[model samples]
Target: MTPYTPPTQDQLLAISVNAGIEELTQSEKFAHAESDLVEAIVEGVGQFAAGEFAPLNRIGDLEGAKLENGVVRLPDGFKEAYDAYVEQGWNAIASPEEFGGQGLPFTLSCNVLENLGAANMAFNLLPMLSVGAIEALEHHGSKDQQTKYLPDLVSGKWSGTMNLTEPAAGSDVGALRSTAVPIEEGEHAGKYKIAGQKIYITWGEHELAENIIHLVLARLPDAPKGSRGISLFLVPKYHVNDDGSLGNRNDLRCVSLEHKLGINASPTCVMSYGDNDECIGELVGQENRGLLAMFTMMNNARINVGNQGAHIAERATQQALYYAMDRVQSARAGAPDKTPVAIIEHPDVRRMILRMKALTEGVRALLYYCAGQVDRGTIGDGDAKNRAEILVPLVKAWGTDTGVEVTGIGIQIHGGMGFVEETGAAQHWRDSRIAPIYEGTNGIQAADLVTRKLGIEGGEAMIALFDEIARDAAEQPTLLALAKDCAHIVRWMRDEASLDDRLAGSVPFCTMAAVAVAGWQLLKQDKAVSAGAAPALAESKPVSVRFFLDHIVPEAHGLKASAIAGADLLYTLPSDKLVAG
Candidate 1:
């Protein structure tokens, strides 16, 4: 496995030009995140990631996380690496000023996540989950709650997890049967006894932090049914007294840790709360509104999950590029001496490598762009907020899908060696495979795009985005056509398509829309390169953007018909007919 090296030039250009980092820095809220300061932060984080995290990735993958005697243990060096992460305050980069954070733009924080994810994806999960919890608390938790928890969470001295999934309720949060009953009178009055079993909790258990803060979704005894009944609670592993000292252990325990396909070093726990009728927690917000608050966390996480896709793809691309240049293979087509040359010289190999490069860069641009919009949204830009909401699903779904595709291509570039564990090409794929599945599966993201996003401002946000793309691609005919097609699809999904019909085509529509967005973002970089804005990437940027627009953007054309195809055919066959005998 090659040590991860940060693609500083490309990353800087993506965040600066495509994401408009300077524009973000100009905002009063993010004035401190000046371009030079952001650059230095990115550089320092890259070095730290390359040095501390990259070296342990293989070991983390091989050893995975362990659970023994009710204790969850991370891979060797993993604890020290996490301690370093907390000690350096990387986790607090985007947290609020009142919460002991630097209060920098989320754009820079996402860059931090990208670097760490590229270096070691599994190791990144510990903090990634914390990021989500921080958002949830910052937005929904009470002042007392924030005063007690936010400091440690922001400082990374403590960790956090989102416990939403139950064994029976994965995508559907409302189906779970967790219950929280109010305490009428006691020292813990106003709090509730939370009792439920939640599964698939990422980083649910770990010793890296001093405490684990769990954001749980449960229902009040008198709560309404389904999603409307859900309530968010802040449940700590150990009770925290008003004076900030730890008390006895709470009633939650990790009954078991899941055996996963990837990110094995991050424990996915099946947590049982109040097994002995002692798990106590307080409401995060108004009752019956937990879903809304949790979405605050999930939405933030969805974008970062997309970020995971981008960086994991970056990692795979780096390894494959290195391997292609180093591995000796058959001679070139016109080699006179017939000496074995590197496989990178092969035409087919070049094709695959370029695809990986183009897609990785393009997706990364979208990731940063999407995150920058989120920061813009935070600063009271309603239009930007709506746009960020629209872009989240696209970035999450397409970015992860791209990650999967690029990693697979990386394997192909490595030939048989890629399949072997020693080459470490397969680990990237194994790790990325989960990104699209978790964080509201890509299918769900697509469904959100079609069902919800297109309905925003009667589809104005979607239309305006496509219009911007179409306008930018005026000189580029292929990209312009795709952008126009996307606009048309938005209108169709909004005006003509029925709910069932829109859903039937939602996944493909998401792919098409994402391709167009990524294409335009790449075009931004291409134009920047041509205009001398990114002198460092003059030669490579155009090549990558050209490939993406020419080869990748056309993929949207193929998805157009499928995207709007109605649901009739999908329901033509009954459930029994499609079932296995």
Candidate 2:
């Protein structure tokens, strides 16, 4: 199993100072205490993650989650670990202080999530989902809904889940068949009786918390077709009393959990709401405005999922690096000793390690940068907000796709043992596989990048982002030409190509943008390090940036060409005939 290393104090400090996080927190009266508080929080989270959560990663994977008698029992130690997590107040690190949370900057929370996710992703999913639920309620929930739900949710006395996917409606949310009927009278007036099945619900039915709050997306009886007519509901597993005590059971149950290839410990549940037509839910926002509200949570989840990619990649990189150092293989080139040397000495293995290092560090920087941008957005910075929106899909898609790639490489580093499940390299690869598929598939993300985000504010966001990257690259002699190459591809996609052409190469284009953004961030770090700040961590900045420029950046031009190639060849071969033997 891989050892989880918390972000170096130097790295975290650099990110905070560069991202204006200090300024943001200073505005909140944490100016004097910012350095000390950030350090304490980071150290506290790292210790909790390594001591409590890391040990259980393997056990959770082995035992997975068990469902019996309509209840979900987490793998042994999971509940205890979750209790430790709650006790440490890790759940409320970035939540608003008014709601019993610490109200720390999102960037700091992201660092905590990275450490925890690397330690044990399956266990971490519980709190990750809860954060999204808190965002939805904090932004869009009714006053009563917030008062009744926010406290326990914020306090970690309760857990939460987002119910969006159905068997028939995974990515195409508009096709969901879940329905809700309005309640006419009594204490529950304006509420709805929700009835439908929701599939792939993460932490949907766990026994670790006093209550489980489900944020469900359902259509009203007289609602129109598709997503526009949909509404959001806050449905608790156990109904609550006027005084906040738990009451009768709601009409919902986890029918089953999926046996997955990776992250088996995080239950992917098949939930049936209102089998007896007794499931009641309060609207989260105005009727017919549910998608708007759900997006508040979904967008947060996208970045978080991107961080998952970074986390898994970081874990995989650590394992691979360790394996390379310990794994003895063929002799090094020109070495007099015939005895085998560590695989780390092998040129190709070193290359692979560097690739993993570059990707992990690059994505980590990008994710943290996005987190900082989010904090800026929260404080009402319009440009920062738009940039954050533009970067979400990139971070989610590229970050995750990179995780899958890096983990596979980690497996490769193990040689024979990597193929065996016992070594744990394979587990990382398996766990990372789902990231690109969920939280909006990478393909959907690409399409969004091409069609939705590229056109935001009449393309001002895209323009500003390109300029931002290019400007930074211009200052760094090593990255100037590469940045120009990236700008050329982006411009080609925007000015010359049709939507179909854009989608054809969306994946590559997205990758190009992510690498460029990451490269820019790394150079920024390099500059900081050049000033003798975090000198040790800074030394690697140039190497990672060089590797990214030489290896990863070259793919952009080709991807742009492929994107402009159009869809003619793709459709020319009939799908049925093409697949025939």
Q: How much lDDT does each candidate structure score?
A: 0.91, 0.84
Which residue segments of model 2 deviate by more than 4 Å?
A: 10-14, 29-33, 475-478
C-alpha lDDT (0 to 100) for residue 471 of candidate 1: 93
Q: Pick out the ten consecutive residues of candidate 2 with the lowest summed lDDT.
A: 24-33
| Candidate 1 colliding pairs | none
Candidate 1, position 289, lDDT:
97
lDDT for each residue of candidate 2 in 392-488, tens digit (9 for 90 to 100): 9989999999999999999998999999989899999999999999889999998898888888886667867777777767655445655565566
Q: Could you estimate the TM-score for every candidate?
A: 0.98, 0.96
Question: How many steric clashes between backbone atoms does each model show?
Answer: 0, 0
Candidate 1 lDDT over 528-568, as tens digits, reads 87888768889888898899888998877788899888999
lDDT of 2: 0.84
Question: Could you tell me how far off, in angstroms, the CA of residue 123 lies in candidate 1 after the best superposition?
Answer: 0.8
